[model samples]
Target: MPDHVLITGGGSGIGLAIARALAAQGHPVTITGRRAEVLEAAAAETPGLFPQVMDVTEPESVEAGVAAARAARGPILIHVANAGIAEGRSLRKTTPEFWRSIMATNLDGAYLSIRACLPDMQAEGRGRVIAVASIAGLRGLKGAPAYSASKHGMIGLIRSLSEDHLGSAITFNALCPGYVDTDIVTRNVESISARAGIDADAAMEIMVSANRHGRLIHADEVAAAALWLASDAASSVNGQAIEIAGGQV
Candidate 1:
């Protein structure tokens, strides 16, 4: 049997793509999401993908989901804290509620997921934790201050944990991608169009152009990065923010 991998937000987009890729490589995968139907649908389409209903924003939900996943496939050897929300707003329009919401899902969620899985990882003496961050995390992304802050917080959490576990068997890392072609990007494009009075296609093009290569990224590209981080090749790649952003800095 292969090692068990738990991926939060694995019902769709990059998370689901990573789960499928890992399962194809013989890993027993548990994919979690806030909606049971979404998770079940994803699991139905992908062999070896187990569905778990979880809301990363809620600690109770994360605890229950992790317990269920561990019960199904022993201790989780790979934990991907990939659940997050992305939104963009200027400082004048940003409200405390919106900022908190993004931080709750993107930063606090990753922290809680890591905390929930670390005990078992420590007990086992070996594990991998990957957070799906973004190039926005590396620096301010102009309009998405809240989203960028949350991502920055995630990298901060991962780096701190990596330092704490320096000599231990577990490793932590983050994948920073730019303009990945996911539903989130689509939604963001629509939001931008509405806010900036540009056409939807133009908004999308603007985002794609942000990448140095002038193209949108594939979900599989990010998934491949996750697989690399989880593989034996990345044993020494701890505390790194591996960028997949077509030269976006």
Candidate 2:
């Protein structure tokens, strides 16, 4: 049997989708989030999914949570550092607190997650590290400098980790997805609608247009990408940021 997989923020949206996909493939999947109720509900419905309440932004919480998961399942061979916040503000309005919050959740959380899971990966001599980054990691996203910088740091972390363990069986990659249809998008639409004084549909349309295909990418599409990266076929695909945005013609 394959070693267990651990995914952060796995109670909903992209992370949950990825966890479900992996579980469907017969891998024991531990889905983690700060919300105990949400994770418990998801675990109850999913056959192979095990819920672990974890706040990625807290280092001690991560270490303890990861140990609990390890005790329940086997060593975590695949670590998906997917927990993150997607808040944005203009540079002029971005406060130090706001910046730190973003970094703590997006970048530092990823680092902690990786550090916690990497030992098992190192012991096993085979592993996969997947970080769910955003298109903003590839290019500047207007009005979201903090979010973009955090994602960029995530990708950089993956790249550096891959190099640090070069010649090992473990592979690290980042998924840079375009705007996907998720709860985050829904929340953003609401915020944008308020900020721009536009209707919800128009605000959502602005995000849809941001994708090259002129439509929001489905959560499953990103999940499929994660599934592939976790598979043996992607063993050679390390130190790269795979883009899920529809390519230009």
Candidate 3:
């Protein structure tokens, strides 16, 4: 059997896109999320997608989820750390609870998930670890200190891991994208509108204009980058953050 691929936050958005793309490539994929209904529904709609309800923020949940997935499928050869929350708040407005929450889900979650699935790759001597980071990781995003910091930490982790396994077959890389046209954007439209006292269209336009091409990026675009990074062709693309921001970032 071909090695299985495990993706966190695979119920929707870029995670779902990457899950479907990998599944269509004839790879058994385990799609994980915090919501069982969402995962089950997504798995039902797509073939070769196995639903594994998990909270990546929790170490025990990640370990158990991967073990269960391995029992059902084979060893996981690809691990996509795509589970994260996107929210922007000024440094003065950021609270301790909010900061910890972002770190727990965005940074700590990736660390735990990779640590759990990496052994399978070591046993087989080959694997792909793709993290769905953001351009904010490459540069601090204004008004979103926690989110930016979390993603920066995630990319740093990927870079360090690639160096730790420099001569190994396992490859570690990150995909840094600008504002994507996902549910997050939809939610952000309303939040930004309310926060900035602007109309919804204006708020949406602000995000749409954030990309250099003056349009929101499709989830498939990010998925394509991930697909490439997960392939043998990307064997030498380790410790790098490939930007897919519609134009140069």
Candidate 4:
């Protein structure tokens, strides 16, 4: 098990679950998010979680966040780039600003995070990077063109890093989950309802039905996969998109 892990967007949802999972294993976890209050609150709930407020989209903020993590808890052995936004807007309806903003937070944010953390990990000669992509990344989502693009780009970034760091102690991989039960899913449900004139529950059902298993995924399930990736058991796993989509190809 890693001694120190840095997780972005760890204030809530899958990231927070990952923080708890790693902390339970006795790994000192540093969780970064844009909201200080949420991060502090989550840290209060989860033992050994150090909170660092950072906007991942900003390179300066990411650099500072990583430095803070290193200062507080040695070199970060595991890095989870889990910060992202899921907005389902059609190509025709999505503006340039919206698309760029999504890419900035999802794709570019992961890149910046990895870039900021590499030097310290390289010095340590070992590192793990787990990017939280989505099943939409594997295939296009009907109404989420921009969101799909950003996730696809995240997978691409992870794959490239894996290739670049081959033979080194560093590994990069991605997790692609469909309809995980989180606040993001709840927000998406509201979006679906408002846009399609359906009830929120029906919108949720639509998402659940998209999964082959016809159910929502728990955040801890995704966190478990991340835990595996961070562990020695998955040393050989790199540059792969581990899917938790029930049955999406």
Candidate 5:
């Protein structure tokens, strides 16, 4: 059997796009998310896509889910730590709960997911770990100190892991995208509109303008980069953050 690819948050958005891209290439894929129905529906729509309900924030849940995936589809050769939450709040208004929640999902979740998959990858002598970090990870955003910090921590984790595993068959990389046109962006627009007391269109424009191309990115664009990173061509591309924001940082 082909090596199985596991994608967290594969029920929707960029994760779903990556799942579809890899599945079409004949890779067995296990997609995990918190919502069973959404995952099931996505699996129904995409052949070779298997659904596993998992909460990445919980260590036990991650351990069990990884084991179940390995049992059902063999050892995972590609682990995409793509599950995360993005929200913009000024440091002054960012509560401990808010900061912790973002950190738990964006930082802790990736750590747990990657840790769970590393053993199998190590045994197999080859694997790919693609983390869905954000451009905010590379640089700070105006009103999202907590979100930015969490993403930075994720990149730090990926970089540190790559260093620790240097010369190993496994490769670790991060995709930093700016304002992708996903459900997350839609929700962020609504939130920004309410918070900034502006119309939705204006709020959306704020995000659109953040990208160097002056537009929201497509999910497939990021997926394409992920496909490349998973390919043999990217075996040496470790500890690097590829920017998909359509221009220089």
Candidate 6:
């Protein structure tokens, strides 16, 4: 087993929850994000959590950040590519810039993060790569074609990597969670309300209704799936996109 775990976009939401869960299990956790303040605050509150300011969209930033994290906590035995941006834009309104922005963060970010961590993992002959994808990856989301595409790309990357490393100690998988109760959902509520000219409560209901259980999934629920995937019992569970969307997808 590896001594250290690294999580991108770990300052808040699902990433933070996974970091905290691993830390509770005695892993030295390094959390990286673009915001120094948020990372610092999260680290301050968590005993085993360390913070690194990294923009996953930038290659140099990812390389340097991964080096710093490795130096701080030793080789990253587990990596979570969780940094992403979710937006709701109709296909007709989605601009080139908007599509690229979402792809850069959700797809390119995961690629960079995994690439930076793979060298050490391969050298050690064992590691875990868990991507925090979404239900959008599995099916079309009504107003988020770009976001859906990005997540689909993420799942594709994970699946391809898993095949490349087949029979090796390393494993790669993706967590596809449905509407989670997080700041992203909060922001989306406002966006949905404005876009549809509806009240915020009604906009929230639209999201809530997307889940088969008629409610938002919790961050910890996704975190638990991540922990399970990282365990030795899941060594054979490779190249899979595990859904946590209350049977939505």
Task: Give the range where candidate 3 is weakest over 10 consecutive residues by summed lDDT.
Answer: 1-10
lDDT by residue (1-249, candidate 2, tens digit) is: 976999999999999999999999999999999999999899898899999999998999999999999999889999999999987789988999999999999999999999999999999999999999989998969999999999999999999999998999999999999999999999999888988899999999999999998989999999999999999999899999988889841
The weakest ten consecutive residues by lDDT in model 6 span 1-10
**Model 6, runs deviating above 4 Å:** none
Q: Give one digit per residue, the lDDT tens place, for model 4 in 94-202.
A: 9999999999999999999888887877998988999999998998799999999999999999998899999998899999999899998989988999999999889
Report the Cα lDDT for residue 140, model 2. Answer: 68
> Tens digit of lDDT per residue, candidate 6, span 133-229?
9999999798899999999999999999999999999999999999999999999999999999999999999999999889999999999999999
lDDT of the candidates, in the order given: 0.92, 0.93, 0.94, 0.91, 0.95, 0.95
Taking every candidate in turn, the Cα RMSD to the unseen true structure, in Å, is: 0.8, 1.1, 0.7, 1.0, 0.7, 0.9
Q: What's the residue-level lDDT of 200 in candidate 4?
A: 89
Clashes of each: 0, 0, 0, 0, 0, 0
Instruction: Name the 10 consecutive residues with the lowest summed lDDT in model 1.
Output: 240-249
Of candidates 3 and 2, the better by TM-score = 3
Per-residue CA lDDT of model 5 for 1-249, tens digit only, reads: 567999999999999999999999999999999999999999999999999999999999999999999999899999999999989899999999999999999999999999999999999899999999999999888899999998899899999999999999999999999999999999999999999999999999999999999999999999999999999999889999889997987
User: What is the number of residue pairs that collide in model 4?
Assistant: 0
**For candidate 3, lDDT tens digit of each residue in 1-249?**
666999999999999999999999999999999999999999999999999999998999999999999999989999999999999999888999999999999999999999999999999999999999999999888789999999999999999999999999999999999999899999999889988999999999998888899999999999999999988888888999989887887
Which ten contiguous residues of candidate 5 have the minimum total lDDT? Answer: 1-10
TM-score of each: 0.98, 0.98, 0.99, 0.98, 0.99, 0.98
For model 4, the run of ten residues with the poorest summed lDDT: 1-10
